[model samples]
Target: MAAYAVSIAKEDNMSTSDITKMLEAHADRLPTESGTTSFTLTDLGDNRYRITGSRATSKHFSRILGMNSPTLSSSAEIAKGGTPAPCVLATNTSPSNGRGIEMNNNARMTISGCSVQSNATGSSSVHLTQAFITVTDGSGPGKLCHGGGVYQANGNAVSATKELCATVTDPLAASLPTPTPTGTTYGNPGTDYSWYGSKTFQPGIYSSGFVANNGRTHYLEAGTYYITGGNFEAQSGAKIIANGPITIIVMNGGTIRITDYSASANSFQAPQTGPYAGILMWRVNNGSCPNPITFAGGAGFTYDGVLYFPGCLLDVSNNAHISTRSEFTYVLADRIMMVGGSRMTIDVDNPYGLAANLGGGGSGGSFALVK
Candidate 1:
């Protein structure tokens, strides 16, 4: 049970003139804004990179060359007397030039009994960044790659891409941002509700806890939503309507559970502008509690945002065909797992990044480093 709201901003329905003025102002800023549309991680030379986020404070990474070997293991069996649906990890942002998954440290990425495909067509090189790699009985990039070597039992493993052994300073947003709407309070902040109804959740701080287990549809408008020190859950056929680009923040030992929804009826789109741009679910807290964050998707589901939980475990299991239709997703957690018949497709072809050329156009859950 999680609930709290300091000040919330509802759909006040701005006037046409107000909308036009806002758009015009945005247009004026576009000419010189190097970090528009989404966050930018600019290599400031001298082994430094500056990350410009939307609502959160800017971050800088100096000497991020640590090491964590990433492992992506796969298992398959005959499903209902049919070939097991291919479970994959890929990036479509630039086809031959995006990372399907990434992580920082000396951890090695291992995969077996599945396939790893980038958008590159016809025997293109697979790209892995900053970590050791391992693959068995799976199809991945060729010998041309960055970081570690690829070993496939089926002879799909590429040569060693040479590890940079860099560390992701804070894969998720380092600084917690204030909510976007600083206007009014919607629900009572101190009370816990088993939220049910076809209503809307404005932007504000729900500091207690929030859960929605009833099978219902809800709309979330544009703004930042804060769920602090509690469990944020949504299950039992809950469908979300992402009315605008928004960010959902979970802080201070807050657990998250979002599952049991029809994927065909939902699509979680990240904000295209601001520090929260491209970030949908962000969990910022010290890794003290053992509670896990569970996120499962149905068939044809898509997540066009960054699921940032640098100090927590993110479980995307026990659900079938999750993240199969993703436009872009970035996962930065202390740990991540996809098992129990769960299937996912992490496409990194949108504005987010996988490989180099972070200018624009690419998508899917980028890898993160674990401690």
Candidate 2:
């Protein structure tokens, strides 16, 4: 599955060069609202192209994604719109192999203006936590959750209401693929760097590795990207635009470290079908090195897929957000942490649907009512 160059666009005035400049500049740090509406790409030779519109916005908020010493700041928050969905799914048995959220023993957490709120009825904001779910506020309710109304999970003695359910369980970790892609067979095999400028990427497996943000913008064609034997990193001033549903799979000792803070605002979504359906980023379970998945600083990092890192720590901070567009979104990890005004929101208007449709055992799950 080697990656090839792909160009898809409906507008003509926007030339390849102009697109390149826009991507490189990232104009307003994020694709302008109008720029993202009908985003497209103009072919520019080799494996390169330019952004066509404003990057869509998506953030993730589960009852609880996963936890091992998870930390949340007073500025942190977890919220969703439409229908109803749990803010954090704590227990692994809740659903989607406990895909919503989980915090095993030894996992610690800190919190502040953080809360789990929803608009829909019946659904609570939290699932369960093996570790203590602390609230940072000293005066007001120590903790908050939206279960139709604002429910106090933890608060000062007199104002305190319910307690977070503590059901400890060592949920099953995500199993590694039996037949992993052999970097040799799949996608385009090439070293197309977008860390300094603008470039486009086609679908397929990127066996070698991928890096962005030496100060540039990378445009990813609508398809699946398999990163093998290397790491996928995006730093300051790096931007990624997806023309359609996309999937990034990290395998063969490859890890994912995306720090699109302040400068780079990467916007990406995962495919809705196939083995990696609904998965925005899939970090291989490296038995030895528990490399963490760091997604921080991208105030406008829109993702509508599940970030499945069963054996790694998933840390999202610095005002990052994960939201759903057309489908549902979930985060499954060994441990999870969200701080610095980070948030996760789901839209029941377009929910993930039944658990069975979410694919595999731990791919995704439905939200359950918390007592």
Candidate 3:
């Protein structure tokens, strides 16, 4: 067997084609005899190489060559799927302590489905420098040191699965307190009531009120309505529909129930334009307890503006239907509790959909941290 050395240096300014030529030149130096020799190529300093190879030793020379002879076992067979003997082995051993492998500016790298275990440290188990790194399926058990599994430094970027194996420690903002409104009390009505612009109703509690008149409209200004102690219900036969946005404050220890009027009329709609055209809520303070803002009937309600509930109780019934059909978005209470027999639905087509939906609806619930 014979040896060959290949070198690639910074001074050479070698291109991909040049590297290919170097590799082929080294390959040409090997002996033509079938499996007579094996070669090992190690990178020396300055991108140079040291190649070494030898022929199988004869019985008499085995001892001098430190070669071991095996017994003649004719039945012995090579294991299937085993790594075949390599005619040559190439090792990248650039001297800057593995710094050569580090990417320079304007370089990028991506890795996927790789297990990074102990006794490993690098910018990343797979380092990508100055480039966009997209990691998918990076889940499962893996370990790393500094940036466990991956360390993205300045000019380096990384993205992994949501279920990354790294520990994240940060304080979450507390949920907004439930609102406490002041005024009169109103309950579910067998018939509906309509309201028009500039209609002044005394500040009080009202609930379980129905909208029996379809064309009838109601307008409420920026006033406080305490829904602390009453059942504010909207059922099938009595739809509590609104074309504009209304602000309601739920007091602590108060329970507000906005439910469906009927199975067929289970929806809420908001106007296509204008301010005060959406459904919104505000919490005055942290309630006596963390109560969710709940919607209990089998009907639906839609609002045009965003539904903002900093804190309150939200519950949806299983047999009920709740849909958002406006361009506005709806938000869930900071904390939500789910009871069986509740349904909540949101329209995907609407840009301003509900932040979260609980109960039997397809959209699940989520709690946003309050600052």
Which prediction has the highest lDDT against the true structure?
2
**Each candidate: how many clashes?**
52, 47, 59
Q: lDDT of candidate 3?
A: 0.34
lDDT of model 3 at position 166:
28
The list of candidate 2 runs beyond 4 A from truth reads: 1-179, 182-196, 261-266, 349-371
Per-residue CA lDDT of model 2 for 157-211, tens digit only, reads 2122233332322222443243355323443322444234577767666666776
Give the distance in Å from residue 68's predicted Cα in candidate 3 to where it truly belongs: 86
Return the lDDT, model 2, position 335: 47
Global lDDT of model 1: 0.43
For model 3, the run of ten residues with the poorest summed lDDT: 82-91
Candidate 3 structure quality by residue, lDDT tens digits, 251-294: 44444555544435423333333222343544444433355455
Better of 1 and 3 by lDDT: 1
Instruction: Please identify which of the two predictions, 1 or 3, would achieve the higher TM-score against the true structure.
Output: 1
TM-score of each: 0.49, 0.49, 0.34
Model 1, residue 319: what's the lDDT? 47
